[model samples]
Target: MSPRFEPITGRYLNLTLLGRPHRLYIEEAGQGIPLLCLHTAGSDGRQYRGLLNDKRITDNYRVIVFDMPWHGKSSPPEGYQNEEYKLTSRGYIQMILEIAGALELDKPVVMGCSIGGRIVLYLAHQHAKRFRAIIGLESAAHVAPYYDVEWLHRPDVHGGEVSAGVVSGLIAPTAPDNHRWETLWHYLQSGPGIFKGDLHFYKVDGDIRGKIDEIDGRASNLYLLTGEYDYSCTSEGTLDIAKRTGAEAQIMKGLGHFPMSEDPQKFISYLLPVLEKIRGAA
Candidate 1:
């Protein structure tokens, strides 16, 4: 028997973000139009392993996923143990632009999930010219805070276990046990305060409902795909965004917040048509 290899390749890069030096990790594969993927809160680029490996997608698009600072294989800035980690909307947007610039990706189509999902709206509104298209998975303008952020980082509590347990219910019951656990593992593996930091941006500062109408994109240029079972970013909320922005939208069935990772095959079924549409318009 021969050892099988996946086409995925990863590398490290040193970049200056927010005027500070940091080391970031990135993975990529396939070739063609650039497709930059953003992971959900508390997770990393590994969530898109399915999309990265799927020849159906990779065959037509070059896929890229970079773990943000303080997440996955990426390391934080030079400061050691000074302040609490927090993700501000400006910083988040700046980081994405920095990464895209550093990679020298020319007007790539950007797709993001959860926090990644929410930010695309801002991207389309503020920098639509910079991207060929934007896709938001489990996207909504605002998600009502479901839990207290403080609990995830308190001294008495175990951050990883509690964080994983809290989000476990967000996954659809239909997800395979293997993938469900894998999704939880990302939460479990998250660094102390990192998940909380992501959520600070996700819950407190990442609301776009007031300016949803301001986001500029045609039906062919913007997309919102939310899992039916995702309570955090309900399909209802996503549909409302679509209604206002007049962007393409769909509610994926039998999937949850972490669609690409939770069930790759099922997620692809919903995604291929979107890819075809993007390709046609491109």
Candidate 2:
């Protein structure tokens, strides 16, 4: 297996969604129902940059990834709240529409991790008919108070750099030294704003757990992927969502929240079954 991923350049573009200018950067390859990949907080679509190398991924689906508003190449509008960045589930759904129009992609398979995963559930609840399938990798609807409170006040407890460093440690224990360093550096670069934004998003956003039934009301395929070690969301939490949404769930062994960075091959392997379902639906 090669560590290097060939660079894929799409027509650089922008769109206004959630009242922010969203800079869309894409690496499009293969052909089928598009799989729009969204990254967790502090990272951009580049997290999936290497996954394109996998023949299974590239041969079967058109993978599209972009920086969310206020993340990476995307910049936040002036006076924009972190809430704008951590958008309510509805905000995220609108974002998908905005991004799709910007890129001229029809409703595609929506795939996301962490907060991105949460977005998938929300979108499914609102417009299940639009998507062919929805995949949530390590997703959840709520955060534990103890952990949330601590992280909500993280900087005061660990100082800015240490807090960022702690997050970096969570990326990939098996990653190359430089990769780990870069991953940590990525969080620090996003800084305190993202943390505040994420917390605000969590606090203000509507819980889709109760509304998950709306998702199951449709024929869309729902799938959940999690690292066996991903402490961010528990198996129980994911299973609960799966059961409620009538979705299938899988937990990959020996991984954490950032599975794409931790183990892309395993990530894609588990994703293959779900992809087959999505392809069949199309």
Candidate 3:
């Protein structure tokens, strides 16, 4: 199929949520049912650039992506730079709710990766009626044996370089050279300690094992997709979450932590089937 040749539209808007004003960078393409994408921690909406440009998806859906506060072109509220930016479940949910309201999205399908993935479960559990569905990429009920946070804070080492070293092993060994490097490139450009701060939420505060049963798949169409090469949040762990939550789970082969960026074409191949299933259910 010929790729969607239409240009993506982008804008910066200030959203006041949770008692703060956040200037967010948002992008969108196409028109139809809304597809809201959340990026992996320490990264930005750039991960979904391929999806935004894909005609097959855009033809049927309006794909929206945004850089979270302090993550990309988005800027944190005043005085946020002075304090540690830890992502709380409540705060994260509020941001999504406010964004959805502002965009006037009608029960958008929410998809996220990593910390983003972990939060989608919370979204489903806390506000099932707000979303048409929730898609989790590299998500699990719990993540253990957290990575070294000190290394991410060391003065001698560049945080980006250290972050790259930490994540390099998690990408699929078979990933294409360009895609692999592109995934690493995002890490290399991330703000200092941002990855570690995000992990504080992903591995610590985001554990949903105790409440996984509260998520109703029939209400929100919860789905989990994990990469075969992801040891951080392994397929086994994701399957366990699915079993507990009664959500459908799939293991994508030849993919790693950053599926969309590591291999967009292959990731799309996997996503299309899930999208079809969701549409049928809707």
- Give the lDDT ranking, best first: 1, 3, 2
Q: Which stretches of candidate 3 lie over 4 Å from their true place?
A: 1-6
Tens-place lDDT digits, model 1, residues 1-282: 887988999999999999999999999999988999999888899999999999999999999999999999998788747978988789999999999999999999999999999999989889998998999999988877877888999889999999998889889999999999998999999989899999888888987888899876593299989998899999999999888888999999999999999998899899989888888887
lDDT of each: 0.90, 0.69, 0.86
Name the regions of candidate 2 deviating beyond 4 angstroms.
1-7, 19-22, 78-86, 148-163, 166-182, 203-206
lDDT of 2 by residue, 106-179 (tens): 77888888888787887777666777788888888765533443453354554345446546645546655654
TM-score of 1: 0.97
In candidate 3, list every pair of residues with a backbone clash.
none
RMSD of each: 1.1, 3.8, 2.5
Top-scoring candidate (lDDT): 1
Worst 10 residues of 3 by lDDT: 145-154
Best prediction by TM-score: 1
lDDT comparison, 1 vs 3, better candidate: 1
Kindly report which residue pairs in candidate 1 clash with one another: none
Q: How does model 2 score by TM-score? A: 0.83
